[model samples]
Target: MLTTEIREAFLPYCLPDITDEEVNEVVQSLKSGWLAKGPRTIEFEKKFAEYVGAEHAVAMNSCTAALHIALLSANIGPGDEVITTPMTFAASANTIIHVGAVPVFADIDPETGCIDPDEIAKKVTPRTKAIIPVHYSGHSCDLDAIYEIADKHGLFVSEDAAHAIYTRYKGRMIGDNPKGAVSYSFYATKNLSTGEGGMLVTNNEEIANRARVLITHGMSRNAWNRYAKGGSWKYDIEEPGYKYNMFDIQASLGLIQLDRLEEMQQRRAQIADRYNRAFSELAAVKVPTVSEGTTTHSWHLYVLRVNPAELRIDRDQLIEELKERNVGTSVHFIPVHLMTAYSKKFGYKKGDFPNAEAWFENIVSLPLYPSMTDDDVDYVISSVQDIVHKFGK
Candidate 1:
């Protein structure tokens, strides 16, 4: 049934799935009074490490911080190059620059929107020190092929797993047994959020220890509780670093969210399944394709690529129609290489990465979150199909 009704209330594109338990956790942290970056944050780090099967985890203020630390901990600095996809957020590339390294752009696998390993190989050079393959929209990149390239070139691998916390590569969790480091986002819209936080997980002790110091204003160990009862007040700055440590309040939320991750993820999966069934066979639409080796997808963003060639309306127009129909939408990315800063700095321009450019042109991210009800999901589906029927060639 094509729902001819427009919702009275406008559905948001995304929302944080916070429960009363999360609220109580924050209240408990506030009541505890030791709220800087204390017990709760440390506990979150430990629990997160265990959940992802990583030997160590360092919670940070943002995924960008983790990415910067990943490069810095490995001594990737000036005169070095880090290859990453232009199909991701600017932070993925910007973090490489933050570490005083050049960010080399690689085109994406058009079908999957993930960085192409072959393109990554093509971009590698004598100065290439690392590769930051983004797990685009919760579909794990071809880690096996990517790591093989890194091994051949003796390059470090810092995975941009902002969208892949629950994604599985070859039946292993995205953060499990990381090659170098895996950075995850905890932004309000992420699958597992702490309002605004991130975590860096790694099996390498050197990298993990370095990240802890780097994110805490370079304060030495044993100084974290310097203000506590019978605690030492002395510390040393190992090196100049950033103030990017996660706070207790955020971790308060994280602790509760982690406990409910599976429950929330099930809802996201159901919504994604609804979307796939609705659009996969539609003539003028293309649903996201879970790439090979991705044994499980996190269903972070249900990105639907509209075929403008077969539709009377294009991507932008579809967005407008959806808005009028009381459904909100977003775009996954605008391709980092095409952004003003990248173009002005690297002399990059459109036509540089044709596949990414084409993918961007036809894509619109529909709302996919645990908070949405079944009625909401069906309404969104009907709205999209109605538009297709009205506008299709």
Candidate 2:
């Protein structure tokens, strides 16, 4: 019913909420002359671990690197099968492969768009070494059920918590449980932005120690330790490792972002609530559901599902119409199983995971970020409503 004029410029799906605080921190890091793997990185790790109530946290270059290192540290390799959902970013599965492990595809919950515990239970075998359950779109997966399954089968659980910066399940933060490794992303568009960085949290002392060594090229000590005053140059390479250490420049941004995370998350929650309220009334669209009183959704992405049967236009047409109205949108994922790399490498096909494929056909991620203004939120809502009205069957 809104008749407001269309936005003159395109509205992006998401944007980092950078402020003078972040800029000042980065400037300070630059002026310090210790830009890589220095004091700032260590401080970020400590603060982030405390924030998530984790026993240990290791900073890395990316969430993919964190996952790869976690898998390697767990000794998961060839002939091992790691179960995961197809309805996720490819990095979730690719890291399993990077460690020479096979990624066993599991279908998602039709409603939650998260990995289904039932499907995971069905896929477990003697070859199963771990389960990489992604907290899809910042909604916590059924961790209790997943953990129960893991306990019964003696399987490791490495949470791909790229979208779950502040998400909680059963009154505890996602990384706090720490029975296994939990990886978080501070990607450009995440709830917490560091431009590019990640962290791995775990309760296992051995994994923590190994991750520390592995992130710094398997060196016995990091550069900051050797280069600082009263430092020793003597070091040793304990094992082969990847160059996954996070730099102080990125950590400087992370520190500022972390300081502002709660405020930013509040804004995101408001946007999500507004979107849910507005979209729930539309016949053609289904709003995302949150598990009331059970989990805290990070609200990282407000994914709306279009019931193609009720709309004359399909998901692609909906996206096009929104774009024409200067409203940006995106699909959370295309389902990892359908990607060429997975299909060609693993012999997966179109119908290998039915739920994921079906869900992929109708989901659209709306513009949700702390940077968006109230007018921007209204513009997106009105645009979507206008498009649905024009295209509804």
How do the predictions measure up, each by TM-score? 0.98, 0.98
Best by lDDT: 1
The segments of candidate 2 whose C-alpha lies over 4 angstroms from its true place after superposition are 1-4, 292-294
Clashes (N, CA, C under 3 Å) per candidate: 0, 0
Q: lDDT of all the models against the reference?
A: 0.92, 0.91
Candidate 2 yields a Cα-based lDDT of 0.91
Model 2: per-residue Cα lDDT over 1-393, one tens digit each: 446587799999988999999999999999999878899999999999999998899999999999999999899999999999999999999999999999999899898999999999999999999999999999999988999999999999999999998898888888985899999998998999888899999989899999999888798876566887878889899988889999999999999999999999999999999998899999999999786523789998899999987899989999998998898898999999888999999999998889899899999999999989999999998998888888788
lDDT by residue (269-388, candidate 1, tens digit) is: 999998898898799999998866999999998899988778999899999999999999999899999988889988999999998999999999999999999999999989998999
User: Candidate 1 — which pairs collide?
Assistant: none
lDDT of 1 at 331: 96
RMSD of each: 1.0, 1.1
